[model samples]
Target: MKIRFLFILCISVFQFISAQTLSPNAQVSILTIGPGSSLNDAFGHNIFRVKDPLNNIDIAYDYGRFPFNEPGFYLNFARGKLNYSIGKSNYRDVRDFYKWQDRTIKEQILNISAEEKQAIFNYLKNNYKPENREYLYDFFYDNCATKIKDVLESTLKGKIAFHEPVAFEQKSFRTLIQDNLDYNSWGSVGIDIALGSVIDKTATPEEHMFLPEYIHSFFGIATHGHSKKQLIDNENTLYEQQNLKTHNSFLTSPLMVFFLIAIIILFVTYKDYKNQKRSKYLDVILFFVTGMIGVFLLLLWFATDHTATAQNYNLLWAFPLNIVLIWKLKAQKPWVIKYLKFLVIMMCLLIFHWVVGIQMFAYALIPLFVTMIIRYIFLIQYFQRSNSR
Candidate 1:
């Protein structure tokens, strides 16, 4: 009878223990990781770290994870329809991964009542469920950093007041992104090409939290409650990135390659001019390439779900009509000369746009732009002389 009573007592104790909540000693911290050399890692990362030694719970939750096995993964990513999900990982494992990549990791311990902590913890738990995990990933609006911002604001019921960083200054979204990217890098060039004029608008102070570093900065200055109590109890550096030299080959850089191509185009154009002849082959190649690029830009703007590709001004230089008139380049038709003149005008407009900062163009494109202008002028003069003959 005593053994049966003891078993009942043990069962009750186990049930009671299972029902217990997190201890008051529990801490929730924001983990901000520094950027790496890769284009994908240039924007850095944000994560939630929940630590409870008494309950033996130490885990990091990341909203940046996406399933590689999802149907049409590449297709969805290309169309801006990719779904990112919340993933839980051991804190040590996440640290080790960043350490291996030589990226710095920092942490900010959040200050709040134990009840608020519990609420936030419970909310994360609910959000990590399979059904609730997935969300549409947008680079500018709803990325990993923005997710942290939204979650904190939502769970706190608008009590958290995010102040502008001490060094905050209003800047266009494109400029802010360019600060993190190398101007001469292929990544920067591709971004300048793919994204349109929309990102050139000035970002609001609150909107700067889209980047992980901005999130870390703004959250540090954040306050809560009517008394303006501080939201961060402490800040820490988990790892400092090592200063290791990375070798970059200059031969493959954009400036060098584009300059060479521009020189070659100029040399060919000069040769044609001296002979009083037009290079139909050269015109065909240039027109085809530029027209194809323009077509691609149009597809990205119209067919794709990507919001940043709309209102692209690169179309001014790479007009799609160039392809349709490929056959007409051989004839000295009046309309052909008129079309060439129109191209020359569009190039001038592109220059005007660049000078006024309507949209930032690639610096490496200067030589190419000059080359295109000279070629178009030569083509116009050639067509005029041919039609007069």
Candidate 2:
């Protein structure tokens, strides 16, 4: 009786271990979630899903999870030192969560062999471990979307090939980013101002996978590098975003708001010109605001680890020296007049940069730029007349 009981216990233990392991029939797929309304969700999301019907196991692994409550979270984020971690959860729960957010979800079932599938599953499991989960996140290079392409290549021993899709038009990183955002939206304007010329370079076909939609597109047409076999076996739309009417008022748009501010600045300058006077307070405000913006941009370029904020040409117009010269706006010094002339020259340089495609500035700033140039020219003339007196 004792020998029979031991034999049964050993059999039960072996069965449990086998059941916990991924079966030969397991499926590994990429889940692409459509963009949401908010700026953070504007780029959409991507996740890896592993499903084993034989083992009754379904799990979703995501690389976008960041611990918001961790120490120095906001500071590290600002400095680009924040670490993002992989999170694993029940596949059904993840699907339901994004569905509740009214985002569309699509799944691309990979055509790789069972061995490759098991390898990817094991890779994700090991990556999900607490000591191994965290990785440095880079927006254009090491993001959630890019990880889907990277992980497959890494785990599959570089057997995957991403071919250029049909009628693919190459675009700069900035253009690709702005494609998902409204042209005149505040978010778009902020991106244009905060990021710099580094993003203006044309991205490679594989680099385009930084966006989740591109990941889905590239992976759909991908194939095994060695055998030239199609990579995707099947594709399915799990959920579709509901058609909802979104209202954006023109009055609140960045273009309209900046236009109105330009009109006000021009009106004040015209009045000052007619009276043969300088608006001391107006000069003070413009100098302070533009100077502060220049300082901030300098910080983003030099003080942070952000790759996109380098080589910003926006500093041509927003000169930081203006902050120190605010008190000297009314001075009869000859150097003050020369400084005003220098500002006008900088404005012309900014226009040259835009024309040459060295960098793309915000289109909504056209009105503001025109008025600012006029204002700087007026300051130069006004200061000259004051110095002569």
Candidate 3:
């Protein structure tokens, strides 16, 4: 009985040691998931897959998980104070889940030494701990996709060199985002409206890794800093997204909807000009809606921690003071005329900004801009004439 007990104890220690380390057959790969239908998933995702057949380990670790049920989740998200956590799951489960979602899954087996692979695996395991898992999420600088590149750089200690892919053309962050979204979609419009000129600057080649597709492309062409060998040993498309018919109704699109609203505004202004009267209700609604949007953008720029929301030029048109002065639209005070003239000047400045490429406004807002300019001019003349009388 003593001999048997000693033998079992030795076996348990060997098993524990094996579990703590990776075998020679261990492999680390990056899994790039294709974009989904929603705006949140428009840029796709990245996961680290560590597999060790000898150790019976295959786990997919991702840094995109957030607690939706956490208190103040939505408020924190809005305030840019949300904490994203590392999540681990069986590799097969993640693959099957993305497959079921009809998203393409591409795997790039990293070309690295066994030691480097072990370091990466150990780092991920350590990061998965409850206290270490949570990190401040940044949309551009720190996100699910960028984490893949960050992990490799941190673990390998400058061993990986990302080369610019062939035929690479640099683009601004906003342009890159719009590339993944339909131009006239509401998602695109909202992004253009809320985000400011900070995203209009050209992003560096390395900065492009913020998107998962770029991470895959750049990683495929990366090289080992020391040996200069290809960083990716093999590339495999584990799941190909099915070609599904996507139906987008043009009639309901932002461009079409905004165009219709602009036409109505122009028609009302024309009637007001002919009859020598103003539509106070229409003016009130326009001011209230635009003012509210301006206030929200202001909050995003000043009140939040989002780096991309700074210096937003959308305020040129959606002036927040309009909300405060909306009640005085019909007043014949000279100040009202001055305010209308200021709005007209702001519209011109908006056009100049768009023309000079200082910022790119939503294409859907073009007609609205024109209509707003016309209405503002009309109001300026009408107010001046009223005050003179």
Candidate 1 lDDT over 8-97, as tens digits, reads 999999766633467889999999999998999999999999888887888899899987897899899888889999999999999999
lDDT of 3 by residue, 1-389 (tens): 99999999999999999988999999999999999988999899999999999999999999999989999999999999999989999999999999888999999999998999989988998999988999999999999988998899999997888889999999999999999999989999999999999999999999999999999999999999998999999999999999763857999999999999999999999999999988999899999999999999999999999999999999999999989778887755668888888998999999899999999999999999999999999988887777778
Count steric clashes of candidate 1: 0
- Model 2, runs deviating above 4 Å: 1-12, 244-247
Instruction: State residue 107's C-alpha deviation in candidate 3, in Å.
Output: 0.6
Best by TM-score: 3
TM-scores, in order shown? 0.95, 0.96, 0.97
> Once model 1 is optimally superposed onto the true structure by TM-score, how far is the C-alpha of residue 73 displaced, in angstroms?
1.7
For residue 267, model 3's alpha carbon misses the true position, in angstroms, by 1.5
Candidate 1 least-lDDT 10 residues = 14-23
